[model samples]
Target: MGCCSDFLQRAKPYVAMISLQFGYAGMNIISKVSLNHGMSHYVLVVYRHAFATLSIAPFALYFERNVWPRITFSIFVQIFVLGLLGPVIDQNFYYAGLKFTSPTFSCAMSNILPAMTFVMAVICRMEKVDLKKIRCQAKVVGTLVTVAGAMLMTLYKGPIMEMVWTKHVQPHRSSVPETTDSSDKDWLKGSIFLVIATLAWAALFVLQAVTLKQYSAQLSLTTLICFMGTLQAIAVTLVMEHKPSVWKIGWDMNLLAAAYAGIVTSSIAYYVQGLVMQSRGPVFASAFSPLMMIIVAIMDSFILAEKIYLGGVLGAVLIVVGLYSVLWGKYKENKDIKESKVMALPLAITCSEGNGHNMDLENEDRRERKPMA
Candidate 1:
């Protein structure tokens, strides 16, 4: 009974992880489609958080009805940091990067989050280091390899001949034009921005992990953070779009995209991720993002009619390989820890018995050697 209960508990997080991946995958496609339809990244972010704030409010109110703690200065500070790191800096940089780069590139860059999170966690002393252990070594090496893969994906276009061959066979090639000088420059700029976005995202992960330690209610904390983020995003948007004409909201695909991002991606996806984090921990929960990248790439090709170049495919493969390496290393490390514990239990029991036998022998010897009093 206990084993079955434990199995179920473990399985819950895996399910939540899958749900978060699906939500993010859908978010990528929807955001790209919305952007193509002329949604300014700023306005989209504002609406995304606004809707997320609204969606989470009812749940927060109900779930946290009677016993909600009064907001303390520390809690306020934590929420402020969450607003700054995640919703503000992270999302702003992400959308800016997306504007300059392809969704595929952005997705590929996201694979670096785990490594960045690991590094930041180590720096913050949240994670222990054991360089002698294969698990730690693998994690360190795998993270570096993943970063290398992201760099390769961003910087190297490979030979034009390979791109030409792949494009000739791919169905979406008909829609996409051969690279032009202007577009190439745009792509380069976008790639660089995406890398920056990835780094910012990594920072957000570290902040979130730390914040979670303080705020026990993920739902309420997320809701409050999103509310604060929405306000910050709106303020930024208003300043950036000083002209009233630019602030006009239209009921089109862009609006739909914003709604999707807010309701589905931000609110639902974040909620699911938080649930998963509770069970799986940050490392396992994050390992699923690369899978979302693959899903997004395929959906983008079919739905958004985007071209898949050979370079993109190679980059995707490298990212996956690197991500798996890190995950596998972590898994092996966990297994070793469990095995060590199991082995130590018997040794501990044997030592206890040996001590008991020694005490018994000493008592017998003392009794036998007693004076005839």
Candidate 2:
């Protein structure tokens, strides 16, 4: 029983990461459907974050009321940027990309995030890279390989596979399958949007890491982020969407998208990720992202009856390989660093003892030499 408890404790992080990825995959699919059903991405952003703020703010206030840190001007600015990058830019562009492309494609592009975050961290000096170390070398090479995979997937789309379901029932599809010219144009455009989205996501990860160091209340921080995101989305919606009717939703997929994205993906995910980042670093939390890509691929293909291409298969494999390579390198580097630190303590103690002994012998020799005095 004790061993089982210990095992569960050890496996908790892995389980949480997998669960979070699955949640994100669901969000992508639901959002894609809602968009296809005539839901506007801009409006979706406003509703999603607004609901997120409402859902999480109470808990944050209740749990962190006593311990919440003061919100200084710098921290407020950082939080505002966080909101802009995450809820506004990243989500809006990503939703637009999904409207133009498939869920699988966008999710696959998201796999490039670990590499992006690694580069950004190194640039920010949050992560140190020792060029001579094999681990660091692998990380760099793996990042390049991941980027190459994403590019190949975006630029080259081979013939679509003749899946069994592609010819059968098309449930909840807004339009017939895309034409060659139209699909190509949209794919290119969506790929561009997704690339920017991924960059923003990476930047958010780095920023969140930095912000957490200053304000350690994870739940409260997430609530603040959600609040800021809601306000930003509101500002954007007011500027772009003029019609009041556009915001109306009675009982449709738009409501589904808003509820699911708000409650599960944004509010819960933000808080959970904050907790995870507190325990593990940002990269560790981001490493689980590839799982969502794979999940989205399956869900899109089988459920959505979306066409899968040969290039996609090859690219997904390469991205997965790169993701693992980076993870392995990071794991090895962390292990080595911990071991080195542990070994350093005993060596330090031994050196201290040796120096103390040498000092005692030198004092005795001096006393003997001055015996006549």
Q: lDDT per prediction?
A: 0.73, 0.84
lDDT of 2 by residue, 1-373 (tens): 9999988975676788889988999999889889988888999998998889899988888988999899999999999999999999999999988888877778878778988888788899977888898888887887777777776776687997676776775645533237788777887888789989999999998899999999998888888898899899988988988998888987888998998999899999887777776666677778778778777866777776666777877777877787777777867876787899999999999999999999999999999889574
Task: Show pairs that collide, candidate 1.
Answer: 100-190
TM-score of each: 0.81, 0.86
Superposition TM-score, candidate 2 onto the true structure? 0.86
| Cα error, candidate 2, residue 138 (Å) | 2.3
Q: What lDDT does candidate 1 reach at residue 126?
A: 63
Q: Give me the runs in candidate 1 sitting further than 4 Å from their true place.
A: 1-5, 156-182, 333-373
What digit string (tens of lDDT, one per residue) describes model 1 on residues 26-117? 77766776776667787888888998999988998999777566688987987887777667777877776676666777777777777777
Model 2 stretches astray by more than 4 angstroms: 1-10, 157-177, 180-185, 351-373
